[model samples]
Target: MSAPEPVVVVGAGPVGLSAALAAHALGLRPLLLEARTRTAERPGSRAVFVHRATLDRLDAVRPGLGTEIAARGLVWDTRRTLWAGRQVHLRTYPADPATAPFTSLPQTVVEDLLRRACDEAGVRTLWGDPVREAVPSSEGVRLRTASGAVHGARHVIAADGARSAVREAVGIGLDGSTSATEFVVVDVADGERPARPERVFHYRHPAAGGRHVLLVPFQGGWRVDVQCRPGDDARHLAATAREWLPAVLPQVPGPEVTWSSVYRFQLRVAARFADATGRVLLTGEAAHLLPPFGARGMNSGVGDAVAAARAVRDDAVEAYARERRTAAERNVRAAGAALDHLLAPRPGLRLLQRSAAVAAPLWPRAGRWLDAAPYGPRIRKVRY
Candidate 1:
């Protein structure tokens, strides 16, 4: 038998790790490449919420993987939305007890768990080596590292994130819009009073001049997101978060910020997930970007990686593009609605939002229409 063509995966993030694991499950050896010496050491949780569909996809790659993740992550079915200190909407996702509706795990932990899985599957990772040049040829994709070392692969999975060097080398482009409102995330710990373990969203805070604050519970602390005016400074964000975080997470007393991050989020997707030869592929933030409102960013990317690997193995990479594109469109729409609801500067929109929030609490039956960002419609599985 001829030597098996190598399958190379770029980036060691969750998407990259998942891609490698998926390929290994399909009887293919995968080489993972990462520019960084190690995973990010950021203090706050980057992406936490993992949806049911994502868990299902992960289980497909490795049997019982979803159960293990669910055991480590936070699983919830109810989220409460408050406007002006009044509980407006108490949305609940009633699902079968066997399958949790949603789960939340820190991005770093997720990556670490995936890396362990890769190790068990005998996948090799080259740390501190970034793929510099990617030349797509009929035979395969020829890649050159930043150190000038050359490697050849039958195909490539680009999971290098939004600032993907591999995507640039292969000339793949993404399109999306950035919201006008800026979001600052801060993870804080309060030993005196622990934060409530629930998804709490405060919209139209009186002290913040109707701005929004989102609070999600993590393992040891609460990850707080403060909506700020465009181009706000860090000092302003810090002070604002310190003053108003309690409005959303009232139980926390004397909160101490451990790590904070400021970023401009967008909703973007690549023109295509795969090249014409199906040799070059994109996954995770490399393929698309969506705000964290519905926990769509990293969660959706995991799905992309799993589907891409299966498609690549089955010689039907186009199916990955078609199925993922549909999901991206749906997620983009959900993100837009969430962003608008978060920052309803317009009088008419603000009134509509307030009415919906009230409707949810008053008539729980009306919540189906008041969902700011529902956990998306069911995505059809791509049969590769």
Candidate 2:
């Protein structure tokens, strides 16, 4: 028998796992190398939204996978913005039964599901085996792991995330700047349920100089994300939490904190999706990163994985680079715009926010446009 078709995937995060799954579905035996020993077990919540387009893609690869995830996750249909004591409910688009609905699930749960799917598909997974170096040649790419074992593959996919070692080794520069705003994410047990279970809760402190806090109900609790302004001490995360929640979420009693993390927002995109050698390709955070404002980061990466896998299967790597690069750039732009609009400091911005709130009910079309436009790209199934 001939040697097995070689494809190596670095990183086993959701994006990495999805890429591996996509490759496996396309009849390629992929070797997935992950630095971490296992999937995350903690309660930290990140990237909770998955779009309808992604669900369709997942369904096509492994039937009922999207439905399985949805059964375990929550469907968030409405978005609201809060200012002082006032709440503005935004308009929502009707769900299309033909396409899957947009759903919110914890990152850990999604990764776990993908891991199980990979196992069932017989994809080779190497844990704690960090790729030390990746060298490309005329024939194929050679990877040396930390344990000194060398492996060769016809193609290498770098899904290792923002601090991608594969991108560094191949010398691809990321283009973008980190934002000034920092966010603190705190997860706590659900002390009480909200009156409205299906809507995302947003609270802006008018007296606190426009500081905003968002309470997203997930699993058995809520994920609290607070925007921190300049000159704020990172150590004051807990104090900020206590001060903000009582005013924002009056219904839920104070919760026992579970996990908290501070992240600085950054928007970046790879200068090139493929390395100079053309044997190595970048996907997920390896290719792009967006501010977490609109949940476009993971959605964009998953789309990249799907497109890249299909391109490789059809021997259209160049087309993969072009398509993914365009998509990444579009997401970066949308994420930046959303962040700017949400975090605006001027009186004009306050006016805009207030206007958006007041007009949402009168002109529901405009409200739906603003609320769904940023995330709309993720739902579009682009042909590679």
Candidate 3:
């Protein structure tokens, strides 16, 4: 009797963990490899929003995994949009009885839950073993780790993020454009008083020198994104958040920043999601990179992980490559549109935004447009 095929998953982020669990459920032996140790510090409240579709994918891997995550995150019922210190739109919906539409929690917490799921499934994980080289043949993939150890995998699922060693080793390249706007993202601890659990987006904040700012509530804190104009110093802005943040967010009293960083986001997709031998498949940020405007990055990556596992189990790499790349393209386009709307780079777009703001008081539809435009035609448009 032959042994069960071995599917090796690279990286130990949410995506890799999801892939490992999915593979195990699909009756395949899975091995997970992480460059970082178990105690590595994962900084920042990255990828706070987890969509319902993402939860559905995780549930398919394990019966109660999605429920565990949903229960642990925040589900804000209010969404507000403002223009130049004036509220343009405000909408609140009643919470669902059975399940929330989505959940907001730190990516670190999600990863912790995913890691726990992997452990429960008895998935083998090797820490501190980064893959330095990956050579694929018609039969399988040969992976050499930083520890000078070689691993032969029946199939390799690459979820090592944008700077993926496995993707590079397989000779896949990402192609897309980057935003001109420098964005400063910060996570702040929950403050005292008046700061309601809601999501707010301000176009041209009056208090912050007319820059754009978005405040989203999560489990224990808020993830804030401030868009910087040309020549603005992101580092300087992040350093002095306490000063300007208070003025912009009067609802929060003396909010303390937990994490802050500058980012010039990219919209990219891999040329191919699989190698020529069909022995290596890319998932998560390894296959695509989208701006965080629509919360498309991590959510879409989860979908990729589940699909990749199914492909490996069914021996249908080419089909996986085609379908996932198509999904990546749609997500890139949607995120790009959202970014463009937020930046308003051209005179026409700026004029349109100003016109919409002026008309918002008289026309509710205009306000709704302003509120929804930043999220890019809803997730159904992408159909991922």
Candidate 4:
């Protein structure tokens, strides 16, 4: 058949926007469709970390977009880890102004920047018109919107998030597992930056009844993740943040909670990244749902976005399906390892952690390991 033309992208999220931008850079006309309007109220500070490679990908698609994000977000150079109120690790690195390792900002803010870039690039986005159905054939695909309007395209990139209608229409299924333990995440707006200005992780924090808590700084506030035991009530913990949060961080008493969520982390990946006809491809959360431990969720989605666009541009849709699914599987493995270490430490790992904490005072490597263990193993770079 003729080469796919007038590429259609489902969803106006960061990944979808990136796909459109990448398509534009590759000289393909793209039409973006989103269910939400421009003024939708997206609440929470979801996906706060953006890796350097993701920024590079965005900058390659549209110059200076990455720089803009870095400027708007905070970059913490210091990392601190504590075990039962005793400091196990404290290290700081020199800053590099040329290129930041990552940027910490709210997902909404990043989406805004991406949408702005789309506007500047003249990418047409049809808002409030979500794709309700997708039918693919040997030649092309046809999409039916929420308003019952039908649109035809040579190819479709589905990035409409976890509950993707397009994915169901294409008969693709997700395979993986979710944890039973719940994690409560809270976003607090801080009037001023904390004195430490570092990313901190606690193992059995004394103030929070020996539960693990992670404190990370974003552009305008802090994200606190509290790991709840199986019997513990995560929703109650989030609901009572005003009372208990101060104990976790004495520095920020009476914190202004902007958003909170109780998450049952999952490591699911789509069974197939593309439809049988190769006229529809999945990207971002539509393809995978990773635990947020190592910040692999959106970063991997961004990678999928650019790769999907390039695959369509080069007429290598099958290759894209295989490679991206492999990447997602690797991400799921890495994230699973991290989750196992953090939430489900076995007896052996528990002993190792305790020993590491005790030896950290004298052995620097032990301290470093304690600081880095929660993030799990890093994967080799894969081209998007």
Candidate 5:
């Protein structure tokens, strides 16, 4: 295969965009393909947290993106845990001047910034032409778009989301299971929250009926997540938030709902992150799936993009697969452990949560580890 051959990037979401941008930085041509005519401008917020390491990855691939994105989003360090209407653990992320802080922004804003970066790089992106199928052979892989136009590439990066067509075409299988917890995500415009700017997670909220409610502030509003039973009505977010959030945060004057959704979180890992010949790779949700907790899904996906591109440039796709799978398994374990603490019917687990909340103030480090990744810090590169 020739180095000049374009690496076809399927999916134009953050993962795909990062992959394309990273490929360009690695001196490889990236031809991006998006099923949608335009980028997502959804009213709802999904995968909104951009961790410190992720900001560094973005800036490395595209100069000044990290600073620009941080400038446009809201950064918060302190996260408090509450139970029965009282503050328990006030966990704080200490200032690390060497690295970028964690940031929160709407999904639309993230996409818009990425789109601008793509334009700046002069990367080729084909919109309205979804990748329908990928035919791999000895020479290269041939991609058939939804419009039936065939494009040939030496390699393909599949960031087409969890339900990836390229993954199905290449015959990859996921190994994990979907969680039973159904989460109702509510995005409210200009919702009422504390003036200090922080994150609040409540367990057994009174109005929420023993379930958890995560309150996160965005650029101009707050995103409230209410844990509901599988059989609960998903459409009643307004009523549920009014009942639970008001009891928890008295400062909320009125929450105007912008968007809402109820989804069953899943803990899934692809059997492989790359093909046998190492010509195709999966990034972001295409490679793994985890609950939205800890903000690992999209952030980790961005990591996948950078790693995959570097692997392609280095001619070591297998290493990329191993390192990414390791990261996915790590994140999955953390998210699962946290979920277990949140929903484990055992009273002992409840006591643990409550204890951590109460003890966090005196022993701040106790609360710090409660809401952290089970493995370690975000894995940036694979060291052989």
Candidate 6:
């Protein structure tokens, strides 16, 4: 077959936008299509933590973007754990400055930055235009948009997210399983500031049954995430913060809730990174999904965009499929392990929790190893 046409990237989320930016940097005029009229302005905070490796990757595209983000977001240097009726404070592992330390910035802000960067790079971002159909051709891939406009591209990228329309149209099977656990995440306007402002608190109520709550500081107040218990009432699960906050964190005053969302844990991966025709490719949630733990979901997606951009730029579609599919599988397994470790039954995890608590304070270095080990030296380097 002749060389594929220009690359078309579906979805305008962070991953899609980043891929567009990367492709533009590589001298490819990528067309970015977004079904939504505008980028997400969701009130609730989604991802706050930016690992050092991701920072390095961002820096490759723009010199000061990562540093500016670090300045805007809060720095979390400590972690507090509530275990067995006792509050244990531990110094969290510090990120390597040379590699890029972990930083906490809202997902909206990050997307906005990427969108702006894409604009500057001359990428065509067509909002309100969704790819309704994708037909692979010898010349390139032809896409039919919702607006009845037809576009042709040498390659197509599916970054449309977990329920990707492009992936379905390409006939790529999403291979993976979903867990029964449900989680509620809320961004509250609570005026109460954490006493220890520089730390993230994981409150485990001894008497609150098996449910767990994680509280992290955000721009206005705290972002609270609670896990739903098995067979819990939906109504009660939805309105859990008001009822459980007092039991979870007795120190804070109630604040107005700004936004709330519930998500079920799903672990999914595409059967193949590229379609049978080899023109359509999947990235981000379109390729795989993982529960939000250790902030791996977003980071892994960002990594996918970076890798996909490299593949497109080099005209190495097959290599891109091989590398990214492997990476997605690895991230899926890592996220599953993290979820199991965090949400395991109290009795079953008590010993492991105790060990972490003890090791964190005693060796300090052990904490750093755990935090940074997942992102090894190989993954830190910018491939493109």
Best by lDDT: 3
Alpha-carbon lDDT of model 1: 0.75
Model 2, poorest ten-residue lDDT window? 375-384
Task: State each model's CA lDDT, in order.
Answer: 0.75, 0.73, 0.88, 0.87, 0.78, 0.70
lDDT of 6 by residue, 1-384 (tens): 234447889999878887787777777778899998884455666777777777777777766766666666666556655544455554655544343356666778788877777777788888987789988755578888888988888888888998898999888888888777777777665454554444444535464665566767644456667777778764566676676666654545665666777887677888898887778888988988877655676777778887787887777878889888887777766666656665655675656565655676566554443332212212332221
Best by TM-score: 3
Candidate number with the higher lDDT (3 or 5)? 3
- lDDT score, candidate 3: 0.88
Relative to the true structure, candidate 5 reaches a TM of 0.88
**Candidate 4: Cα lDDT at 355:** 93
User: Predicted candidate 1: what Cα RMSD to the true structure?
Assistant: 3.4
Query: Candidate 5, overall lDDT?
Result: 0.78
Give per-model TM-scores: 0.88, 0.87, 0.97, 0.96, 0.88, 0.85
lDDT by residue for model 2 over 321-365, one digit each (tens)? 888899887777666666666676579866766677677767765
> What tens-digit string does per-residue lDDT give for candidate 5 at 1-384?
233355888999889999999999998988999998884445577877787788889999998997778777887777777666666567567534345467788867888899899998999988988888897765568888888788888888999999999999999998898877678888767644445567887767776776677888878777787777657776676445656555545546665667777787789989999987688899989999988765688889999999988988898888999988998888887667666766755789667666776777688775665544222333444221
RMSD (CA, Å), candidate 3 to true, equals 1.9
lDDT accuracy of residue 381 in candidate 4? 55
Where is model 3 more than 4 Å wrong at Cα? 1-5, 192-194, 379-381
For residue 265, give model 5's deviation from the true position in Å: 1.7
- Compose the digit string of candidate 3's lDDT tens values, residues 164-222: 99999989999998887899998889875536788899998999899989988888888
Better of 3 and 4 by lDDT: 3
Please give the range of 10 consecutive residues that has the lowest summed lDDT in model 6: 373-382
**Candidate 5 regions with alpha-carbon error over 4 angstroms:** 1-4, 39-41, 92-100, 191-194, 237-249, 354-384
